[model samples]
Target: MKPLNLAQFHLLIIAILLPVFSMARPGLAQIPKEASQIIDDVVVTAEKRKQMLKEVPVSITVIDDLEIQDRNVRDVKDIFNLVPNLSVSSQNQNVTYVGCRGVSPSMINRRNPFVMYVDGVPFSKISGYSADFTNVESVELLRGPQGTLYGKNAMGGVMNITTKAPSNDLEGRVSLDISEYETYLFNANVSGPIKKNTLFFGLWASEYQTRGYMENDHPDQDYYDDRNILNVRGRLRWVPSEQLEINLLSGKEIRQGGDGPMIGDSQIRFHEYKNPDDYVDADSFDNALHARFHAKKFDIVSTTTYRNATEDYDVDYSYGSSSVSHGILDYENTTFSHELRLQSPDDRDGIAWIAGGYFEYDQDKDNEMSMQYLPTAMMNFNRKTDWPCTTTGKTAAVFAQTSIPFFNAFKFTIGARYEIVNKEMNYHRTTTNLDTNTVVSSAAYTIEDDWDSFTPKASLDYRISDNIMTYVSVSQGYLAGGFNNTIDDPDATTYDPQTSTSYEWGAKTSWLNNRLSCNLSIFYMDIKDMQVTEYPSAYVMVASNAGKAHSYGGELEVKFRPVTGLILSTGLGLVQGEYDEYMGYGGEAYAGNKLKNTPEYSINAAIQYRHPSGIYTGLDVQGYGKTYFNESNQDNSVRDPYAVVNLKLGLELSHWDFYVYAKNLFDEEYYTSIFTSSIRNSYMVGSPRTIGANIVFRF
Candidate 1:
C-alpha cells in the first residue's frame, strides 16, 4: 500500500475540525455556563499518595485515558515521544533498550536503570515489559531517581500503570478496527457489580493481526513481517466491609511475529532474505493477590504475585546475505514476589508516612544454537549453548515524610527512605561445537555470586503560593550486580553493581485561573561503576565496569486551554551526557564520547478540541535530535533527526464511539536502532504509515 501525501492528510484533518466548528457551536451552547469556565484537575500518585499534579514536588507526566486513545499509544514504545527525555531501542522482540534522561543500562543480563509497575505489582523482567495495555486507566512517568518509594532498578525513573476496576453499573464495550496492509483488530471488555457494593468482576480480551510492510523480491510469495497478538485479563474485587478489601488479578499476553528487522542500511523499501526460517514467538502470564485493611489512624496493604514468560526466536545472522549463518535463541523464566506496606491516614494535618518490605525469587533457563550450511563444501558447522540460572532477593525499607504549614500560606516538606537489598544468583552453562554431526569441542562451567547494597534518599520541598510550588532533592539509586550471560571466560563471569547520585530542582505553577499549567525541572547525576557490555571478538561479548560518568539535563512541559473546547500541550527536553573517563579495547581511550542512545534534544506538541456534540479531533507531532547507537560515538553510529505526525478524529454518541486515526502520516523513514558489531552494521527501522478507523459500542 502506498502512503498518502503529507500535505493532503494535514488539510483533511484541519478541514474536518474547522468546517464544522460553526455547526458545533450551537451544541456547545447547551453546556452549563460554569462548566465551560472550569478546568478539571489532574490527580497523580507519583509520590505514593493521591494529590494534585501541581502539588507534587517530583517531576512527573500523566497520560489519561483520553490522551492514550487520541494518540494511539498501544505499547510502551508508542508513548516514548509523549514524555520528555524518554527513548527506547528495540532490535527485535527479544531485546529492548530503555532510557530516561540519558541514564541507560548496558545491553546484557544486568538490571535496567528504569523499572515498570502494573496494577501495584513490579514487572522487573525485560522479557515481559511488552504486556498488553487493553484496560489501563492511567500511566504515570516519574522522572529522576525513585529510590525512596521504590527500591533497585529505578535509577533513571519509573513507570507506574493502573488498570480499570469493576464499577457498580453494568458496562461493556466492543471495538473493531481495519487499516491498510490487511491489518485488523478486535477488542471487548465487560464489567459489573456481582453484589451491589460487596463484590465486582471485570473481563477484557483483544486480538490484532497485520501483514506488515516488508516485501520480499526474491520469492513471488509474501515475505512481509506478519504479526499476531492476543491478550486477556480478569479481575475480581471484594469489599466485605468498609475496613477490609481484597482483589485478585490475572492476565496473559501472546505475541508472535517475523524474525529479524525488515530493513538494513539499504532504504530500498523491500526486505530480501533468502532464508525462510525466520520467526519469533513470545508470551507471558501473571497472577496477583492484593489485600488492604483500613485502621483508625493507619492502613495495612499486602501484595503477592507470580509470573511466567517465554521468548523464542530464530534469525538470519548474515543480515540477508549469503553467508549461510543463522541463530536460534530461547528463554523461559518464572518469578514470585511479595510486598507489605503500612500507610498513615491521608487526611492527617501534621505528618504522614509509609513503610514497606519486599521479596522476590526468580528461575530462568536459556538456550541458543547457531549453524552455518556451507553448500560449497556440502558440510555443516554448528554451535550450541544452554544456560540455567536462579536468583533470590530480599529488600527491606522504611520511609517517612512530614509537612509543616508555615504562616498558613507556605508549607515545608522533608522525606527520606533507607533501603537494604541482599541478592544471590547461580549460573550454569554448557557449550558444544560439532562439524558434520561429530563433536569437535565441548565445555561446561558453573558459578555463583552474592551481593548486597544500601541506598538512601532525601528531599526538601516548599510551596510558594496556592498555585505555585518548587523543590530540590538529592537521591541515591542502585542496580544489583549479576553474572554475565556471555560466559566465555571464567574470570569475566560477574560484574559489579552500579550506583548513582542525583540532584534535582523543579517547579510547578498554574496561571490564568488554572487554565494554564507549566512544569520545569533541571537535574544532574553522578554515576560510578557503570556496567558496560563489550564485544571483544566476532562472537564473544562480555560485561565489565566502566569507570565513571556524569550527565545533566532539563525539561519543560506546558498545557493551556485557550478556549472552552480547545487544549494545547507540549514538552521539550535538553540533555548533555558524556563519559568522564573510560578505557576500551586495546587500551584505547573513550573519555569524551557521548552516551549511547541518548538524544540531544526532543519535542512533542499536540492540539486537541472537543465539542459538546461529541465531536473531537487532535493533531500531534514529535521530533528527536541526533543520537548515537554505540559507545564509540563514530559518525557511522549516529541516527539523524526525524519527526512524525499523527491525526485522530472521533465522534462520541450516547452509546457508540467512532474514530479514525492516521499514524506516521508522512511515511517518515526513521531508524529505531543502529549498531556496529564485529565489523558488521545492523539497523532496525520504524513502522510506516498506517491509516485506520475503529467503531466502539458501549452500554
Candidate 2:
C-alpha cells in the first residue's frame, strides 16, 4: 500500500467537506436538533453521582451512543484515539496494558494505577479489567488523581462504562458485518416494557471471528484462529412511588480464542515458530449482578461479580528449528468480588455536600500446569508440574466532598477519603528438574499485610461569566498494595502502593454563540515510592518500590463549528516524565531518563461535514513523538516518531446508510508495544492499512 502525502491528505479532506458545504448555507440549520439535545443531556459518573458534563469541574471525556455507532469501534481499545492523554497496548488476547497521565503498572501483577468501573460497580480483579464491551451505552474517562472519591487503585485516573438499560418503549436492532480479511461480526439487541410501571427487560448478544494476521509457513498450515464471543444482559426497573425507584441488572460474557501472536523475535532469521497454530489458546467468562435503590435522601448500591480466565500457550526452545519444544503451559484463574456503597443526597443550600461509605471484598484462585509434548520415556523427567495459589483482600473507606459558595462568583470545594486495606495470600509449588530427574516439592506459605491511607483534595473555581470558568485544584492519590504471584522467591510478598500529589490549573470557555469551545490545562505530579520491576533471570522478575519520580504535562482541546454542516476538533498534549532515581546496568545515573512507553508529545485532529442531501464525510489524523522503551534510556533501541491518518466517507438517506473507511491510510510501519529482556526481547508491530465499507438499513 502506498502512503498518502501531505498534499494528497489535505485534498482528500477538501473533497469530503466541499459537497456538504455547497449544499447547506453557511451558519444555517447545520446543527441537528437531536445532536444538540444529546449534548445538553450528557451526564457523567466522575463525581460518584450523576451530573451534567458542563457542570463538573474535573477533566472528562465522554463517548456517547451516537459516537460509538458512528465510529464503528469494535472494542474498548479502539476508543483510545478519541480521548486525550490516554493510550492502550494489547499483549495478547486477554491481556492489555493501559496508561493515563504517565501512570501505569510495570506489568500484570502489580496494582493498576487506573481503575475501571461498570455502571456503579468497581471491577478490581486483574482478570476483570479487560472484560468485553459489546453492550455498552457510553464510556467516560476521568483524568488526574481520583482517590478522594474512588479510593485505592485510582491514583492515575478512571474508566467508567455504562451498559444499555431496558426501555419503556418497544424497540430493537440487529446487525451483521463482514470484512475482506475474513472477519465476521453479528450483533442483536431487544428491549421493551413488560408492564406499565413495574417491569422492563433487555437482552443483547454478539459474536466475532477473524483469521490470524501472521503466516506460519510450517507444515501444519494452521492459522492463529479466534472463536465467537457470546454476551447477554438483562435489566429490571420498578417505581413503586413518586420518590422511590429500584433497579436491577445482570450480565454475562463468554469468550474463546487464540492468544495474540508475538510480532517479532529477538533473533531474526531463526524461524523457530512461524505458524499461528503454535500460539496459545485462551478463554474467559465473566458474570455480574447489581442492584440499586434511589430514595429522596439516600441511595444504596450493591454489586456481585465472578470471573474465570484460562490460557494454554506453546513455547519453542530453539530459534530456527521447529523440532525443539518446551511443551505447553496452562494458567487458570477465578475471582469473586462484592461491593456495597451508601451515598447521601445532594444539598440545595449554601453548602452542597455528598458523603459516602464503601466496602469491597475480593478473592482469587490461580493454577498453572507444565505439560510435556513428547512421550513419557523420552521426557526423562516428570512431565507435569502444578502451582496453585489463592489471594483474599478487603477494603473499607469513608469519603466526603463539600462545596461552599463564598461569594457570588467564587466557590471552594474540599474533599477527603480514609481507606483501610487488608490482603492475604496462600501458594504452593511442585516441580521436577529436567537434568536431575528428581521431584521438588514446596510447602504452602501464607502472607498478610494491612495498610491505612488518607487522601485529600482542594479546588477553587471562579465563574467569569455564564459561558466561562477558571479553576485550580490540588489533590493527593494512592494505589493499593498487592502480592506478586509471578515471582518465584518466597520473600517476594507484596510491594507498597505508589502515591502522588498533583497540582493543576485550567480554564474552560465558549464563544461565538456556543459554536466554539476550548479547554486548556497545565499539571504537575510528584510521585513517591514508585513500583518498579527487575528481572534477574530469563523468566523470573521481581517487584519492588523505587525512589520518587516526577511528571509535568499540558493539554489543549478545541471544538469548533465554523459554519453549517462543518465540524472540527483538535487536541495537543506535551508531557515530560522522568525518574529522579533509578538503578541500571553498571549503576549508572538515570535521573533524567524518560519514562517507558510514554511519548513527549502527541497531536490529534478530526474534521467532519454533513450535508442536507444525506452525505457525511470525515478525516482524522494522530501523531506521536519519539519515545524510549525502557527507563534506563537506552539510545540504540528506541521507537521512532510516527503519524497516522484515517478517512471516512458516507451517505445517509431516510432509512439507509452507507460508508467507507480507510484506517492507517498511509500504511506506516510502527511498533504498538515493546518489551526488552536479557534472554528474549520482543516488540509488537502495529496493524497495516485497512479499507472497507459498510451499509446499514433502518426499518
Give the candidate number with the greatest TM-score.
Answer: 1
> Each candidate's TM vs. the true structure?
0.90, 0.86
> What tens-digit string does per-residue lDDT give for candidate 2 at 241-261?
655555666656655555444
Q: Judged by lDDT against the true structure, how good is candidate 1?
A: 0.74
List residue ranges in candidate 1 displaced over 4 A.
1-37, 218-221, 266-270, 321-323, 367-431
lDDT by residue for model 1 (1-699), tens: 122223334335434543354344333211121115345678887867677787777889898766776777777887777999988877666466788887887866535577888887676555657655667788999988887677778888998888888867666656677777767776767787999999999999877777666665445336546677789999999999999999999988898877535554635354655345577888889888989898999888888988888888776656554654555667777777887888876656656677777776766666443433333443444555444445555555565555555665555565566655555555555555545455554455565666655666655667778788888878887777777765656577778888889899999888999888899999998988877878877555677777898889999999888788788899998888888877885476778888888999889999988888889888999988999987888777798999999988988775557899888889998877775675466777677888998776555
Looking at model 1, the pairs that clash are none
Superposed Cα RMSD, model 2? 7.5
Where does candidate 2 stray beyond 4 Å?
A: 1-41, 108-110, 124-128, 131-135, 225-228, 266-272, 275-350, 369-387, 434-437, 440-444, 486-492, 584-589, 635-637, 697-699
Task: Give Cα distance to truth, residue 343, candidate 2, Å.
Answer: 4.4
Task: Point out the worst 10-residue segment of candidate 2 by lDDT.
Answer: 30-39
